[model samples]
Target chain A: MAILSLAFKSLLNRKLTFFITLFSIAISVTLLLGVQTLKTETKTSFMKSISGTDLIIGSRGASSQLLLSSVFHIGSSTNTIKYETYQDIEKLPAVEWAVPISMGDSHKGYTVIATNLSFFDHFSYANKQNLTVQSGSIDDDMFAVAIGADVAQKLDYHVGDRIIVTHGGGEIEGHDHDNIPFFVSAILSPSFTAIDQTLIISLEAMEAMHTETHDHLGALPGETLLDSDHHEHHDEHDEDHEQHAAHDKHDEHHDEHDEDHEQHTAHDKHDEHHDEHDEDHAQHAAHDKHDEHDEDHEQHAAHDKHDEHHDEHDESHEQHAAHEHEDTQDQRIARLLKLKPENINAIFVGLTSRHAVLGMQSYVNNFQGEPLTAIIPAVALQELWQFFSLAESALNIVTTFVVLVGLLGMLSIILMSLNERRREMAVLRSVGARPSHIFGLIIGEAGFVCLTGILLGVILLYAVLLILQTPLANYYGFYLDINMLTSNDLFILLTIQCSALLIALIPGALIYKYSLSDGMNIKF
Target chain B: MINLTDLSFAWNKQPIIDIKELTIKKGEHLFIEGPSGSGKSTLLSLLAGVITPQSGDISILEQPLNLLTASQKDTFRANHIGFIFQQFNLLPYLNVLDNITLPCSFSGIRKHKALSQSKNLESEAIRLLNALGLDDPELLQRSVNELSVGQQQRVAAARAMLGSPEIIIADEPTSALDSDNRESFIKVLFDECQKADITLIFVSHDTSLKTHFKHSLKLQEINQATIKEAV
Candidate 1:
């Protein structure tokens, strides 16, 4: 014990060099622990993000792609599944609830996901945690929309705001459903899932937005004639052209572009203004193609054809944009609502019982009618985690090497001091210290150096996390949890300490041999 | 208190010390003189139980040191002998007081004997320091590197005499000091040895210091094997 104190004093006597050694070891420890913590947390977040969901089924394609597109809103589904298939699956005895999502739209750069009220009831993420509407209630309101916390925060939108949906999923530019914008009905709280980054709307609204630009608005059965029919579906409204032109002129906001082509946006705004006052005209105005959220893969008319189609839509924009301004109040209220969804990107299926999942999965995968694929979310996620584990191990190896270098530095530093300390050793020997004391003293110094380095590394790790906590959680949805140390982290620390002790033996043996050789009479 | 008979030693097959017989009575302050490499330190190492004789036997305080194990000899030396080096005696990292108390950590018997005389180790260190004319209480906490050569020698003396060891060995302690300082150092050393009735085996080439001891011997005169090598 006295020799141990002597070792400590010996370290303090060389304080500057001691700290340098401490810092190197601390840096190594921080790197090792940092890599370990990130790997575990990433796996945790990934597993938790897709929990509670049993199966994700999409039209015939890669299972990983299907999982990515359906749950994570990444990539595109291989093929669209028909609405009839959705109905058929709902009728299956093993099916508990089937919520269909139709993608391909964006609102303020946030992906819009179109589904029904069942989504609000069945969809769960992050350990089976249900989505919560922080502000408003869920509904199937055609013109009503619910936005996720991220979408709301980033776009600065709130409930009751009118926001137009974009035609595509990836970017916000190009054609938007400005003609028939939906009112934000609710804002969902953050759930640390893909849903937190999406906007939600009703399936029928998605259908209506797409069907709004079609020429078949007035040609339907018994009376699918839109609200604009009351104003005359014939060419009599040609006189209203000059008025619509004046409205388009008033709608222009950007500094660029020719006034002759209003891009349909200006006209929609002016037309809505006119519709608000001219109650009769509002009843049957044509609203250009309104869009939905599930899959915003709106096949555009190509860049060169965009102007040509723009001119065509400009001609029809008068008929449709004017037509929908009034249709919002009339047709929507007339109970002429059931616009059957033609296709959907993916479907989330829940089973009546856990046992029914395997049977239903096979049944869906082998259905002769249409090629399809089904995947258990957890299984697919496990496969993904396995791939990530390779990188994690590689990262761990690099940090471990750093720790080794640090330990080696400790050994070398002690060795360098050995020459200068020979007389100190001889003096100790003459005072009756045995070889064992000298051996213990050397080993004890090395061990203390290592422990100090480890504790500093851990403290630095926590410091960085605390500083980056809010930004990471907000932008990346990574909630770094601070709790009791994981078994793996403690194991790493133990490994470091044990390895340091082992390394000390090399120098300890050297000190022992040197002491016996020098005896009480140091040559110097 | 020390005996050596037919003791022989060599470094790399070259004979260094070959003594037929040598004996020193208890409480005798023996001054051993020698030139630079006349095997004085080697003989002291043998006497201190640090290096066993190559052949033959050595006995100290009625125990056969050659018969004991290396660790046992180390323990035996720690309990009974105190050593003052020529220079660099005190460990630089420790303050003056800690250097003096270093032996008690290894030899529990010495620590208990020290405690019997004082309240604690620090007080006992101070008491010995006071007796040796290095009574500056402030110097006790200063690093060994900061003290003057004379002050350092006194600290080493205090360390050797702290636990009342049966024998105290000084190896050229005055080699670093001037004439005046060396004389004062030997006087204090002899005074402490006399007070404790300790056998002082002091090695130095300074013949002037020989007058301070009760007996004196030249290392060459006693080491007959070294003379044979020289001839």
Candidate 2:
């Protein structure tokens, strides 16, 4: 207590120089801690942002790009997987749930994702916890859209409001969905990941738009938009009855009517063979018609030589329609998985367990099929570290420089004051005070100055963080609570204090040396 | 009593003070005179044991000052001797009273003796302050810096003369004061030394004050041409 009182009194004597040293130390510590705190929070946030996602499957583009487009709002994918492939992947024995993501569309500058309603049920950020709706619910209807919290707030979107989607993945001009405006059905609470930066729509809606686009573009010369394979096949079966009335376009129409009536008659007999078996019946009918056409061509060729030539020509025409119908049905089912004309670019999988990361990895690595991959949202996002590495290094360099400047400033100030204090020191020595007493006095003064400065700096750090918390959350989805000191913060502050003390010793040592030889009359 | 036998000293290989077989009885008042270059300060330092003689035995009260360790010498000086330097005789940061009490704070023997005579010592300090012709009420409580050089020297004399230490070493105590002040300071100091029956070694260039003291010595008479040459 006596020492403290004396120290306080002595410090009060040199308050200006003492406080200056302290304030500089405090500012440096605050800057260092601030930079470090932001760096750590960003890394933790990035890692936690995608922990719940198991695997991210995208089009057969680069795996890293697919992960980025699907998980992080980093880059875009080159293409998308076929719808059929997505369905087939879902049916695999090891697969639990597969959420398909259709990319390559955008609203304003935000990426527009075409996914099922299950996206809300599955997608997890920060943890494996399910995304909760803060205000509105998930949109289930095909044309309804869901926007993340930031997207909604920034764009002033509300439920029941209609908005048009812009095409080509960004703020591009051409092909706006002006004809069919979408309703804003749901807005997610902020997660601060790619969700906050994207728009969500249904896969059916995406498929419809693609199909409409294809129809808008004129078809090729040899192509036809024929309806059913069964009708086309039957038309091929009756070619011999057709060409006899060579100039009759009405005959072709009449043949179609007869085929329709026959199809209706087949439906009437649907009791004998249920509608579920209709596709099987069609397959059998196609084979039988092909055989009959072959027999007819052979018989005509055998019977009358001129009639055989015309009959053969008619038979060929009937076979062409039957083959066309069969090919059309196959093409439609095959198009579901093929990525060329229309395909799924990404998949958002939500697993039943938090260990869904394993499931995601298993699917990507063990799936026995064409080249494919699964990515857990968290892992994939972490793997996208180009920005994080750059940010960390840049912040580290700046913090280090600030700390050096702070220490140097303190040393310079303390050393300067020591020069003015020589007379006071000599007086103490003359009054029967030992050299050690002078040394202790100087060191104690420095330590007190540093500790005071660090205390002020800590208070300032909390105040600044508290002030910026709201804005940071609103802009970046980061919720930094400044109410209590986190372990990371405590560690940083401790290190700074220790470092300041270490720096303070330099001046103390200088004074100690000065008082040593100069006890005779300490001028230096 | 003080004793010096064959004392020799030097600075950077140049001789300073060389004295052989010098002794002062317990009640002697010895005055040392010297020009600016004469080694009066060096011999005083030697006698105070602030510096070691190259070849000598300086014993105060039968303890050889040079034979004792440096720390022991400090203790001996604190307990048995009082010093008045040419300047800075008192710490400027302390008030006049505190400066007067500082020697007692460091030396236990002095402290015990001064405390035993505490009331008398206070009155004596006041008397000495009065005798020095500094009667202002503000002067006694004021910081050392507020006092004139002569007043501060008087305060230093009172401090050194307090508690009746066996030896009092004054090194040009009046150098900073004017002729009139210096004369008054010497008279009072010489009278106090005689009254206390304390041995006094006063080093100064002012030979005019020699008439007041019982003993007078010149630095050059005892100083060597080699080891005790002038600084």
Which candidate leads the pack in TM-score? Answer: 1
Report the C-alpha lDDT of model 1 over A393-455, residue by residue, as the tens digit: 789789889999999999999888888888888999999999888888888898999998999
Native contacts retained per candidate? 0.82, 0.12
* Residue range A1-524, candidate 2, lDDT tens digits: 32344445557766786777778878887887777777767777667667555677765556568766777655665565666667777776555677787777778878888887677777776767666666666644445688878889889987766677777764556777654456777788777777887888877666555544344222211123322322332344333223222212323323453354344332233223333432333332322232344533442333234223434554454332322222233222212111122467776655556655676566665655545666655555666766578878888888878877876787777678777777666545444444455666666666676778778887888788988899998887786645456687777666766776687678767766665444334242
Candidate 2, position A327, lDDT: 29
lDDT of 2 by residue, B71-178 (tens): 566567667777776776776546787677766665778767766655655565676566556677566678787777788888888788766788888877887889
Against the reference, the lDDT scores of all candidates come to: 0.77, 0.64
Give Cα distance to truth, residue A377, candidate 1, Å.
0.9
Two-chain complex of model 1, DockQ on C-alpha atoms against the true structure? 0.75
Q: Positional deviation of A277 in candidate 1, in angstroms?
A: 7.0
Question: Mind sharing the TM-score for model 1?
Answer: 0.84
Shift of residue A160 alpha carbon in model 2, Å: 3.9
iRMSD per model? 1.0, 3.9
Best by DockQ: 1
